[model samples]
Target: MDIRPIRTDRLSDKIVNQMIQMMREGNLKSGDKLPNEGMLAEQFGVSRGILREALTQLQAQGYIRRKPKDGTYIQDDIQSMLMNDSVNELLKKTTYSDLLDFRETLELKMVEKVIERASDEEIEEIIEGLGVADNEKVQHDMDHYFHYKLAQASKNIFFMNFIDTYYDLITEIAVKSNRDQVRRNQIAEEHLAIAKAISARDKEAAKNAVLHHMKMVDKTVIGEEGK
Candidate 1:
């Protein structure tokens, strides 16, 4: 059977994606002023009205800001707001297994990035900063804390923020299903292996460490098949 036409982006969303692309590519930097509406509309090949709609959404999402006369400029500190409320809400709809898969991938990439980009001092910092989240603190998650510090070491905001967004769900699960002291000790050692591997700049070891940790999580939380 032939497939029907795929759903395409709404015109305004297409425009919005282009601008966000520009920002991602460094063509548009935070605190940089934008061209006037007429010129921007011409550049985007869209009606001024449609461009305005896209801009309105960006402004609401913390991507841009307006002034009485200075027109629009990129937000001065945009990185922290990269994962806005809308994306966070969408992330909420994912299943626990889906989240486990995502977490495994994100942490592995973070380890790789940390190995590649972090300074020696940064590596040491990461090694020392493996925070022990006291399970007694119902609000804290030991697992999330360890991985988040690794994310920071990776020096990639997008990855770091995704891990940060993941914290609430991890904490919720931890609170609902308390592990025994034996499991906690095992995970803590797994985390230590990850940090040691990262400090040694041994990518394969780091990958193995992360995989083992995820496997333990998968078995206990989502079962062997992650179903």
Candidate 2:
């Protein structure tokens, strides 16, 4: 706990790393209020300027948020991952086929993590997300949200951000390449099953559910393009 006397040169970065460590160690979980700036400055034995600078970086990284009078707290949602400059390069080179393939990879992984840590309330949101099936357009949007929320529940901000930025193209390709109503229904069912397994906290079952869903996407959706 005594992380003092580290050095003066890297004070800001060291403080940032310390806070990130707190988050990783479950000391500062999401929604947890950070120690007040004055308190943190006292604890870290750093100047207030150094502490504020570290907090600024954390806020920009989406690791925490600042409220007007409530002070800083951990963020509930992930930040956008499209900040990497290479995203533009990837987009320029990416085809519809590539987008479909990428989605299969991302969603499957997201589902696997959701199975590991999602709570009952989170699972219920996902289950309700699947019930938006009255209309095709609405169903598709719901399906996208379902996947996005599942990723968010994984506690992996990078994955959530990546999907949010690119999911539109993914849905466009899915709708165009696989117009079969039965197949759409199957996808919906798979999402529900994944949520069920996560709610049950059966890790292996959750993994299997996600992998099975990805296989379906591979066979029916991505398979249509022959890539």
Candidate 3:
């Protein structure tokens, strides 16, 4: 159980996610008896009640089992729990507009970071990434990796992590059913301009390029939402 006080409002969710991680790491197995309520509360630095609440949620979610006289045990069908929870969470909190907004902010900030730490090697990576995007058989994962590589070139840990986390959301949107070909072409062109700006060490140009890229995506998303 090894619960801890939640630092954020997503504490219960964090507890569940950590437990799932433990299972994935092989630290916990099906039918494993998790630490009892008292010990679990101590481990998480939270009170008994919060720990119980988290455990109850897990049980209802089919991630665990609890017995009156016995202890809590991991569920046998953990994958189903994981799949359902992940999909529901993604659907509940995410929308096309959300992805657009995220890409708009993250891409522009990534440009600022890239300009601040631009180097020959970094510029080369960005050029390679752009080449990948130009391919006819380009896949979402390929595009995601391309952007991730460009973010890595920025040599800023914060920028890299931010892009890695949010880039998938952009890839999801880009691959969605409603994706417009005309807007996609516009965005691709913006990517080319951004790469050129980075290659030339033009910070302002790179920032403006990303801003324009996002503006186009924003407009497309809004237009689609209206329909």
Give the TM-score comparing model 2 with the true structure, all chains together: 0.55
Query: Which ten contiguous residues of candidate 2 have the minimum total lDDT?
Result: 77-86
Rate residue 104 of model 2 by lDDT: 65
Q: Alpha-carbon error at 39 in model 1, in Å?
A: 22
Whole-structure CA lDDT of model 1: 0.78
Model 1 per-residue lDDT tens digits across residues 135-171: 5343236666667778887888777778888877666
Return the lDDT, model 2, position 147. 75
Residue pairs clashing, model 1 = none
What's the distance in Å from true for residue 3, model 3? 30
List ranges where model 3 is wrong by over 4 Å: 1-95, 131-139, 170-172, 177-184
Residue by residue across 1-227, what tens digits does model 3's lDDT show? 99988666667666777878887667887778999889998998878877888888888877899888999999886765555556545644777677567666777777777777768787777676653233323644555665777778767655555555565545544555224455446656777888888778787898888788668657755664575
In terms of lDDT, the poorest run of 10 residues in model 1 is: 131-140
* All candidates: CA RMSD (Å): 7.4, 11.8, 11.7
Descending-TM-score candidate ranking: 1, 2, 3
Error of 3 at 107 (Å): 2.8
Number of clashing residue pairs in every model? 0, 0, 3
Clashing pairs in 2: none
Q: Give the alpha-carbon lDDT of every model.
A: 0.78, 0.73, 0.69
